[model samples]
Target: MPGPSPHLPSGPRTLPGEGRTAVVTGASSGIGAATATRLAAEGFDVVLGARRLDRLTTLADSIGARALPLDVTDEASVAAFTGALDRVDVLVNNAGGAFDARPVAEADLDSWARTYEVNVLGTVRLTAALLPALRASGAGDVLFVGSTAGLVSYEGGASYTAAKHGVHTLAETLRLELVGEPVRVIEIAPGMVRTDEFSLNRLGSAEAADAVYRGVREPLVAEDVADCIAWALTRPHHVNVDLLVVRPRAQAAQHKVHRE
Candidate 1:
């Protein structure tokens, strides 16, 4: 899969955003934080939303963006979140994460449920809430920061993989349904990104997270993925990036990660 663009020609098209509003979920850390900053620099009025208010405030302050407390899994919270926004042109769904790496047979039901709620249900809620505004904007974009896990299954990644697969399909279905509509649905699936908390939260230890990237060549970072998001949104309104799969060279595939 391709990661970043080598060079992109500036098309003679209307930029999706030129003085527009963008809502970024999971802005508390990692890819979310990186994307929030990126969009802001791209001349967007960025709103940062996440459960962690303190972190959100910090990021918002640094980037001159608004921060909102949001829990995408809760319908009420999502309602309040969308209600607060007067206008939204772009919505970046970056709030999901992996809970555990257990096989299907030994899966922890709670972990799986949590994964689905946040990864799939949360995205559905937010996207539904913002659809009306997006359609009205005439150049709206819905971008999902998915994972390489969505494309291929692995031994101990059933739950995450399944949830991402749902996300992948959701993007596909939404795009097909929205044809000729003003809005566009795009999905960015990345592999083997080394963030501060991703591997640590999944594998449960500073040591374990360290080991995941130890002896590997440079892995993709949160900012790298953010770069992709910014680039896609800048394209002409008619150019919809259907699905982009990005993986670090070391991570050839989900099950074929190169450790050394």
Candidate 2:
């Protein structure tokens, strides 16, 4: 069975159209899509950002939110995403992924660069661009979707682990930098989420993807992560959830997994 969803405080949290807005990147699918939907249901005017315009549009339509085409790797695209926004109270930096699995000595530099572009630099660009809006809102809450790979090492995960470590550092630094301000920075490190495209996207092949988690029992789901994010975002203004780590019962560690 899946774990219980995280709990929220017992007060009126930030509400939608309360003159506040939320921007969710990588909103085309998985945790990003689920977070966007969850935020919308909580009455937040959500801005969905992703490379796939059609997917963003569909998500926005379903959630009654706005859509923006965002290629996190592109400076201009990140600029456009932040430029088009106003009074953003929440920012979920969920636009990132690993391209492939390979040893460091044999790794493709191009793939490594691509991963850094989306995972590390992309979060930096978007966060920097929206700092002003976040500062202006006085209730800025930033959430970065990190991974368990960041907290530990694994075979064929050099590039991804490096990028996620950078993300973790960035979040930590931001938390310190924004201490004087109302802005709060947080990181959610998830483990083995069974998103439809995650493994396929990483391996770039159906067979390879299928082999990764073929026998895993009760792997984490997108909604589970989304629920955690929602709970974090809804915390009282004075409370800040610095870091949250969530994994399925079958996943005890990065390499120590119980596969049925």
Candidate 3:
């Protein structure tokens, strides 16, 4: 007996939709917001997730993307964020930030735990909860927004760097595990990005945050990272960009930055 053909007469099946759908975490500001906007411009219906409802709503309104309030640390919030979506072609896990900077010797255990809560556990929870939807989509693309800090540590950034290293490893492992599935996992690691509130959010003080990059010339911007993410997503299915690390020319590495 002849087996049924897996191939179709016309061609291999593609996602049967005009506009693709994407769910972007941390979409209220910075790289998340910029990526959501870019996806919309590329004809994707984006779902914006963040802890800030007002900011999410405002950003969604501007980009015509749906808004969902999500605290990735909370399992319930993670469930609701993925539950509301019928189909999500792309998942951008970007809802992480550095906690207060303190040396390991003086580090508060609670602060260290908080960083892990948001960066490591948050990504894991969200990704697991949405795996079914991603598999269902048949054109699933998962993007993890990592940092150069993961690759190389800096002084006073032990917790943040450690958390990011976990994210980087997760992305790598996922790529291996999902090889049989029709899903692509990628990591976008950025150097110092000049965002409005990144340093402020990381350091817990606006003045202190400003001081870190005050004299640096032409650091990478939020849009730059966003653009890289969009580019990776838009590539043909046969081409899988495994890992991309982007940094400004001024930034050679975490340990080396030119300040003039």
Kindly list the per-residue Cα lDDT of model 2 for residues 1-260, writing each as its tens digit.
96655674655776743566989999999999999999898888899999999999988998899998999889888877778876799999999999888999999999999999999998999999998888888888889999987788788999999999899999999998888898989899999998879889889988988787789988889999999999888887788888899999988889888988
Which of candidates 2 and 3 reaches a greater TM-score? 2
| lDDT against the true structure, each candidate | 0.91, 0.89, 0.89
Write down the TM-score of every candidate: 0.93, 0.92, 0.92
Steric clash pairs (candidate 2):
16-43
Candidate closer to the true structure by lDDT (higher is better), 2 or 3: 2
Candidate 1 — which pairs collide? none
Q: What does candidate 2 score in Cα RMSD to the true structure?
A: 6.3
After superposition on all CA atoms, what RMSD does each candidate show versus the true structure? 6.7, 6.3, 7.1
| Rank ordering of all candidates by lDDT, starting from the highest | 1, 2, 3
Candidate No. with top lDDT: 1
Q: What would the per-residue lDDT of candidate 1 be over residues 1-260, giving only the tens digit for each residue?
A: 97557586555654445579999999999999999999988878999999999999999999999999999999999988999999999999999998898988899999999999999999999998899999998889999999888888888888899999999999998999899899989899999898999988888999988998998899999999999999888888889998889889888777777876
What alpha-carbon RMSD in Å does predicted model 3 have with respect to the real structure?
7.1
Candidate 3, residue 234: the lDDT equals 90
